[model samples]
Every structure is written in C-alpha cells, then in structure tokens.
Target: MEEEDEQEEMYEVQEILVDPKQKAVRIDKFVTDKLPRVSRNRVQNGIRSGSILVDGQPVKPNHKLSPGELISIVIPRHGDRPDGIVPQDIPLDIRYEDEAILIVHKPPGMVVHPGVGNPDGTLVNALAHYLSDTDIPVLPGNDNDRVGLVHRIDKDTSGLLVIAKTESAMSFLARQFFDHSIDRTYQAIVWGAPEPPDGTIERNIGRHPRFRQKYTVFDEDEGKVAITHYRTLSDMYYVSLCELKLETGRTHQIRVHMGSLGHPVFSDEKYGGDRIVKGTVYSKFKTFVERCFALCPRQALHAKSIGFIHPVSREYVHFDSELPEDMQSCLDRWHHYVDHRRANNQLEP
Candidate 1:
C-alpha cells in the first residue's frame, strides 16, 4: 500500500541544463522540448506559479533563461493525468466489405471516440487496426479517409453501418443519408405502444428545456428538423416492441421521440426505463443488460436491416445483423411466456 501510494505520488526535479547556442530560445518552447509528455497548459501553469524557479527564484512563464543560469524546475506531482489514446488491436465484426464500401457490426459499450473518462478501446481504435491489417481505404475526402469513415453510430448502437472508401463514394453516401433515401430500420423495445400503431413523428428535436443533457421535442428556433416512423411489433402490458425506420437521423432521435411520446426504450437510463426482469433467458438477459448498463450503457437497439442505392453501381445494396444474442433472448422469452400462459389457462378451463 505504501509503495503504491508512493508510486502514484511521483514527482521530479530537473536541473537547468542549457547549451551555449540555445540561450536565445523561449522558455515555454524550451520547457515543451524538455518535457515532451507535458501539455502546454501545464507548463504555463507551472511557470505562472512559484513551482518553476530560475536561478533559485520564481520566474514568469515567458522568461527566457540565459545560458549558465541555474534554472530549477520543481516538477510537481501529477496534478492531472494524461489520457492515452493509443490504437489497440481489437477485432471488428465486418458484415460486408468491398473497395467502395464496408459494413461493420459495432458492438455495444464500445464508444465511437475517446471522450471524457473513456480514453481507450473505441470503434476508432478498431478501425485503425482494420486499416493497418487490411490496407483498405477508409478515408472519404483526405488521407485520413484511408479508413474512409463515412458516418458514425452511437457507442451503444449496433448494426449495418456503411463506410466510403473514396471521396466520390463518401459524398454519395453522405447525400443518401442526408436525403433520407437509405432504408434504415431499427428494432427497439420501448416502454409503451404508440396510440396509433403506425405513425410519423414530425416534431423538431433540440436540447431539453430542463435537462440540457438530453434532447426533447418542442417548437424552438435553435432545434433541428427531425422525423421518425415507427410501427408496433408486439404489445405487452407495460411495454411494447416496435420497428423504427429513420426519416432523418438526429442525435438520440429514436430514443428522444419515443420519450417525448412518454414511451422511452427499455433499460434506457437516459430517456427512462431500467425495468428489472427475473427469469431464465431473461436472467441471462438481465446480466447482459446489467453489464451493458454498468458503464452508462443501454440495451442494444439494433439496425436489423439497411438498404441503399450502391454509390458506384447504382444498384441497391442491403445488409442485416440478426438480433444480437441478448435481444434475441428477450424476444424468445417474451413469446415463451405468452405461449405458456395461454396453454395453462386453456387447460384450467
């Protein structure tokens, strides 16, 4: 315990070593070169404080030390840790691949990019490995398009996502998604059924009035135009299964639209329900959901099917990811319960 604490409380002090020809250089630059891992902000902060001493006295952030001056740097222990975003060799479930496009299955809980509190094991990192190993182009416009990443899905959302390998393909696919020509259908377990079994939500979505963290539907100028179409698949006592086809893909569009209608998705901590289930497949499902939720994760809302006009050939291209295991188990268990209850009642009568 003492060793661990000492290791965490690490600090350093460096003697000012200056070259005869390096006397004209700036202090911040000198510090930056000396400490390549430290950020510019930290160097500036250190200089402004008395922690950085020049010739055994405090100096401003801008002071350039002369050669032969004894500059003392009292490196403070970690005030903040750097977030390391190194690319790791992670496996990606690729559904379809070609020179023009690639369809991948993004697993649940893998964040699309490095963000606050999460700095590793992202979809971006996975794509990095895919590029190095396969030598495929992911870039759409520039050299970074070597991965030709066309669009992105949420960290938790899984299914058929298309990537463009070339600039032409990228522009074409971007336009397709923007114009809502691509057929994108998702299977969602929402809290309740819509009053009308099949309908469209034309409400605009913007930041919520009360909770800025979430999106809401209301008449506002700052909001973006959004639309969604949903059809009831199955109706339960407290919840329902529905197929959502996107007319316009906006941030949290499906989840927010359903929430605006008072029907958020199941196990959706952001919009609403985290209903606990106790059973067999559902027990495994409960564990799956709990694990997914262990890190602000929600139940996977899968893109069951996607159809689009081929960017290069003009012919249609379609792909699908079967309901992921956990969700499939939920549906199977729901049906099993219905069948068992119906047969038991019939036998009793």
Candidate 2:
C-alpha cells in the first residue's frame, strides 16, 4: 500500500524487529502502518503473492506478529506495467545524454507521463520509442507508464528532465531528489511585484477540501511542508519577473505559494491568474495587459535549470535552458510597455 518510485526494482525487501512490549498484530495491518503512503490492499496483495515472510517463511494476511520475532517482507514490484501503452515516435529536445542517463528539454503542452485522461502521446511514450531496444528496468509500485522518470513538472511548464537508462542510475537520481540535493530553479512572471522583492515562502500545502483537483495552503498540521526561495529579477511596476528555488517538491507548490501571496503567475488559469489582478482599470492599460496575455496564453513559468550529481560518473552535472519563445515574447512586451510609459512621462514635462 505504500507509494514507491515507479522506477524501482521488482523485488524490494525490508526487515523489521518486533519489540517485547508490543502485542500481536495482523501482518497486513502492521505493514500498512509501518510504510508511509502504503495502502492495506497492497499489503494484502503482497501477502497473497507470498511476498510477505516471517523468519524466512511466507505468511498469510491473517497471520499475527509476535514480540521478539524477526519480520521480513519482499514486495513484488509492478512488472512491465507500461505494456498497455503504445510507444509513439515523438521527437525530443535532448540536452545531454550518456550510457546511464539523458537530460531532455521538455516542451510545453506535453504531458510528462500517461494517466487517466492522458493514456498516449506523453513524454514516456516518446521515451519508449526512443529507447525501444534498450533494457529499461520496470519500476515497482508504479501503475502507469512512467518508465524512467524520477520526478515530474506540470504539463504547461516547459523544462529540462533527467531520465535514467539503468536501475542504478534510477536509484541514485531518486535518492538525490529525496535528499533535496538536486538544485532546481524556475523563472516566472507574476501579476505584481512582491512587497519585499526577495524572501522565502514556507508553508504547508494540501489538497483542497472542496476541489479535488486543486491544492491549498494549510495553517495547521494537515499538509506537507513546502518551501520556496524566490528573488526578484526585474520590476516592471505592474508585473515582475522572479527566480524561484525549491527546497521541497510538493505538487503545485510554486503556483499555490505564489497565489497565496496575491502574486500568481501570469496567465495561470487554475489559480486565477487569467484575470488582471494588478494595475489600473483604465481601458488602455487593460487592453495592453490583454495583449501581454495573448503573447503567452499559458502560465509565464519555465524550469530554467537543474543540477545534480551524475549517477554513474560520480561527478556533478548541471544543465540550463533558455526561455521558450512565448515567455520571451511576453517579457519583451512588458519591457516595451514600461519604456513607452517612461517616454510619455518625460515628454509631458
């Protein structure tokens, strides 16, 4: 029942020692409580598959654990889970590649992996086609076709991604992400300039109670701790360009955190960035802002860079990407607008 990395091996083993003061408990329940994000059904399935063992002997789900005993569990990882997915020959913007790993520049409008609504035409499908002849390991606990992905970015956010070609590479890269050793930076254009210009936004993020698809910040201990360090790069009066560094990779952390500060990313429809949140209500200014929106219909955000230790080389690797055309065009317009207004003011004097 625990959610594990999809790129992990088929057989993962864990050993635990029971305490003398502990009472007898069902093996399934014991495991479910022990593993974070694991479910009861998964533990039962593992037991049924004879993957659960006590003292080197397979046990049933109803079996109870005793004190002062050794418990070992062999989780059967999901095998060839992407068999149902058909690979398509989609082109990729590869940045760096070697025997063990490859860094790809993912374009906007491409889904990272297959899911309920998106079953095909994903980045995974393209990777499958690109590596059709290679032997990529099937990761445990992953139900979908995310072959070698260690992490993911939003569909609308274009960025660089590192993919593992071997199991050792996968494990090493995943560990780096879990330890927060990977350095990731993003560039975004927001509605208005933040008051302090540069600061850290530390808040807890959880699923919205009413909207299942959206996320929100929590004041209590309900959500996971999320931290983002941001600094202003350009201040254009109405809107500002900022760089953000993440300490944790929670879902929608950057978007939700910035939205809570009343400076949502430009054109982010999910967090109400489509509407004008700053600037005058005059028809001329509104129209100008509309033109800026038209230049970049999606959120004005991009994964600019990422750095991590090379899994096989034991050396540090860093990759950076330029802003996409849409975002660059949007910023150019903002700069032009600011310069034009300054010229008008000088002429009036």
Candidate 3:
C-alpha cells in the first residue's frame, strides 16, 4: 500500500509604486498592460478579493489611479490559483536556463498551457511540476497567477520559448513582446511565389464570416493592424519555402495573412488548405511523401529563432531550434519532389 501525497502553495501581495508620468491610467488596464501575460479576469478577481489596493485602500476595477500614487498588490502563487500552473517532468529541450529565466523548444501539437478545452499536460503544468520542490516568493496582495510566463505560441507551432523565473523579469519581457522589440523569425511552407523575392504583407486582421474558426484580412467588423514580411527561400514545383518576420502578433496572423495571399500553410485544413494531397499538381509527389515520410502530421510551420534583451542580465541573447523530426522529414520529401521535378523539367513557375 502507498500513502497519498498532497501539498499546498501560499500566495501574497506586494507593494507597487505608480510613476508620475503614467497618471490618469485606468488601474486594471494599467496592470493588464504592464503585465501582459496576466489575464484580465485574474486582475479583476484580485481586485474584488481585496488583494489589490490603490493608496492602501481597496479600489474598484473601474477606478483610475493617479501617477505617483502608491499601489499595493497581492499576487498569489500559481499552484494555489485556478490557473493551476504546476511544474512537471514532461521533458523539455531547454536551450538556456538561469536563476531568472528558462527557455525551451516546445514541440508542435503540444499546447502551451491549459485553456478551455484543454486543462492539463500544458507547458504551464510541466513548469509547475518542475518547480514543485522549489520555493516561490509571492507578493502579499496579488492573486496566484502565472509568475514567470511572458508570452505564448500556438499548440500546433513549435519553436523557441522564453519563461521568466522572477516577477520582475516577467514584466520586462512582456513589455518587449508587446512593443515588438523582440525579434522572432518563423519558417513556413506557402503556396505559389510572389513577384519579388522579399516583400511585405500589411493588412488588418479580423474574424472570418461564416467560418468562426478562421481569420481573414477583409472583414466588416473591427480588427487589429497586422503585418508580415517574407523572403522566398526556395521556389520549386507548386510550393515555396518562405521565412516570415512578424510586425504584430495577432491570432493566426501568419496563417491568415498567408492564406489571404493564396498560400495557406501546408497541411493546414482550417485555413482553406486540403490535408489530402489529391490535387493534380502534387499527385506524384504526394504518393512519394506519404510512403517515405509519414512523420509530418500537421502544418509545416516552425519558430526558427528568437532574440531579445535578457531581463536580468540586460545582455542581448538569441536562441534557435532546428526543425523538429516531423517538419524535417516533410522537408526531406519536399527536397526529393523538387529534385524529381527539376530533373525531368516538369517544374512549373
């Protein structure tokens, strides 16, 4: 017989000082803007629970704070919070780790963290389990939330990711991402070739009509500004490999904008791409890929590199991950198809 195990984590709030230059800012909005990763719901929850204060008095979420006003915030440890971020030994390809930061290469199809349909096996869960034995100092009044989380990549995308080990680092890193100061490069397989080798695709992105699961560039509703720059790396057969640099990190920005340009991600069934390779253009190559390399399951997208200023050391650093097994295999087959077509002069422009 084995005894059951259980543990509890404590949370507390910390003091915050308002800057005179940031006066007239909405308190909740200010916090959300300052802590981009902290969800607005958590911020509101902290306010209602009296875990947050302005000038030592509990304030409503709608209240505005003056610059130079002292702020008292209580941030709870994540384990005790509903967000339930815990560390686990889920095996990570860590490129770098320090007392103030942790960076990993998240594989494709692995969710970043738990969300509505997903509640576990997240990067958040693994992080929590990894730090289960470690001590986390919480602020007195702040609610228990993700402590070191800075930003996120989608479940189906794989690449370099950064995690903050301290609250100070979290805030700084979040600002860098929000202000577009961070350099993130992504590799994608798109359809067709644009006129120039390198070009820009700037458009407003919003939800798609009739297709709620997808996004589009032309919309009747309000949308955020989006921009993507790409350079054609190779053009062979009907597909082209492109490198994308983002100017804005909107939901599905890369996929949607690429689709708008007539090139949805390969294997992307959501954004008008047929997962089946039955089209006349890919008939022969499809049979070859499906037989030789069946490893590539999802879209052939990857985060190739990320560079930023280290929040703790203040030193600039860059990190990169090679294409994972699946994408690598896909590229292998792609190379084969390109050679086959070129050898026979069957390739199209």
Candidate 4:
C-alpha cells in the first residue's frame, strides 16, 4: 500500500484534448505517457472495457490519436471497475468505530479495495455493506470506491487501517499521513541478522522499469525518498525477526529496502526470500526451510501496531495487533529448530 503509484484513493475521471499540432500515437501509449500512475496494460483494459474513449466513441487500444481529438477515461480508485464496487457480505475485523472514523484490523490476503483481477470481496465492499444505513457521503472528494479509507496496507500484509467516515475526519487523517506523523510499525521475518543489530536505511524507491509489478531502489534523481528504521527482535541464525518503522511511505519500501540490505523478508517470493539465502546446505536444513515456507506461503510480514491522532477527539490513539496464525506458527517452528540445534551443539560457528 506504500507503493507510490498505489497511493491514489479516489476514482478519477480525466479528459484531455489533443493539441492541434500534436503528432499521432497509439492511444494506449499516449494515455500511459500522459498519466502519472496509469499503466499501458491498464489503459488497454480501459479501452476494451469502454471506460476509455476518443472523440466520444470507443476505440481500440492501438487507435491513433488525431489532432483535436478528445480522450476521456475513468480510473478506478484501486483496481475496481468504476461501476463495480457493490455492497457485499464479506466479513471484517472491526477494531474500533465511531461517528467520525473506523479502525479495522485487516487480515492478510484481503484486498483493501477492488481492482482488475479482484472485482469484489474487498474491504471497501464490506464497508459499503456495513455502513449501508449510515449515509456517509463517500469521504468528500473520493468516489464511492474509496469510501472511508485514508490509507491501506498490502493485500498480503495483515495490519491496522484507519478509515475516516466524514469529510472533516478524512481531511484530518489524510493530512497526518501526508506529513508522516502517523506512526506505524511492522514485524518481518527476514533472512540473516542485520549488521549492528539495528539502524536506519535511507534510499529512493520506484517501480522497476522492466518489471512493472516489482519495485527497486533508485537514485535520488529518479525515485521518491524512503526511510526505514529496523531493529532485530530475535536472531534465529538462518533468519531473524525484525521490527521496521517507516519514515516515508513509498511503494514496496520495506520489501525493496530490506532486499537491498541482502536480507529479504522470509518467504517473500517477489524479493528472493523464497529460496535459502543463508544457513547450511545440509539436507536437513533444506527440509526445515521448505517446511517453514509451507507453514507461511506468503511474506512473513505483519503490521504490528499503529498510532495516530484521532480526528474528532483531537487525542492520540494507538492500536496493536497480534501476529496471525501462519506467521506465528512459522516463527514457532524456527524457534524450536534453533533451540534444538543449539542444545545439540549442531549450530555452525
């Protein structure tokens, strides 16, 4: 959810007219180059779905733009179809709620909002259903897809999220997040112990040029600034549990930063933690790692805690969450493995 491109929380309608002297280009490429977060694939999908049109008519993705032609598009808040966010019966772990806001403990694997591959069963859909009688007018500037959401975590990262139920609440909470005053802490099982136990990582992060789905560190001139402060909670030899605090939120900031430090989050297939990055090559060790991966098929990361100012009450509020079963069970196995190896004097020097 910290990905730069994934920051938008409102459905948007954009209209652009080609200049009289503009050169002809494929609509997909033209739209992609013109928009900030829009991808070529998303543009093509929009064209196919008839959400994108030129000169008041639907066109192919490869349709060439002509001078004075008008281009119009509707970008979904996340990936939901502009018209597809319907109230559903999806369950939510509501932690706290009031007239001004709602605090939710989002579980792993549940998307915060609907998108292309995901049409429903999202937190937004559930909120729509839960607040059906509240008459909450869609958080001011945002469309119904966003509802009360001010920020979000990844679909695979379980954690706390604050939702603003009113215009004043949304403005207040959004400002806090933009100012980096909303404190958030995450626990991640990462490969190897970090050098010096704890420190801060300052780098720029941006989407990979070749792999659009992945993010990588970039130079100051290219990407946005990202900072993560981390401390090792437990060193299990082969892997360590780390607590990370973010100063600036960029897309995949923690994943990219930790991977750059040579200790990717454990079992994070996208960042190369799915393989054995450290520890012995013994068959037993390999088997143990494979089992651990089975215990937690996704990245071993959790949004452990969050603290922020309450918009209406003007008081500081903090929320904490326990690790989910998959992550906890995986850690338990690692703990047992480490203890047994140490007792048997089998650990490498």
> Per-residue alpha-carbon lDDT of model 1 for 1-349, expressed as tens digits?
0001111122335667676767576676788788886656556655654445677676777787688776655443332324323556888888898877778887766666555776667765666666656665444222221244444566667666676654446545544554467788888777656789788988887778798777878775667777888999887534568899877767788888887887777777777756543223446545644553443246537778888888678789888878777666666655565466567762111
* Model 3 agreement with the true structure over 225-260: per-residue lDDT tens digits: 778899888874556678998887777888887888
Model 2 regions lying over 4 Å from their true place: 1-82, 133-144, 346-349
Query: Candidate 4, TM-score vs. the true structure?
Result: 0.77
Task: List runs of model 3 lying over 4 Å from the truth.
Answer: 1-83, 134-147, 219-221, 275-283, 289-293
- The TM-score of candidate 1 is 0.64
**Residue 55 lDDT in candidate 1:** 74
Put down candidate 4 lDDT per residue, 260-289, tens digits, no spaces: 999999999999999999988889899999
Model 4 RMSD to the real structure?
Answer: 10.9
Worst 10 residues of 1 by lDDT: 1-10
Reference-based TM-score of each model: 0.64, 0.77, 0.73, 0.77
Estimate candidate 3's alpha-carbon lDDT, on a 0 to 1 scale.
Answer: 0.67
Worst lDDT 10-window in candidate 4 = 2-11
Worst 10 residues of 3 by lDDT: 1-10
Q: Higher TM-score: candidate 1 or 2?
A: 2
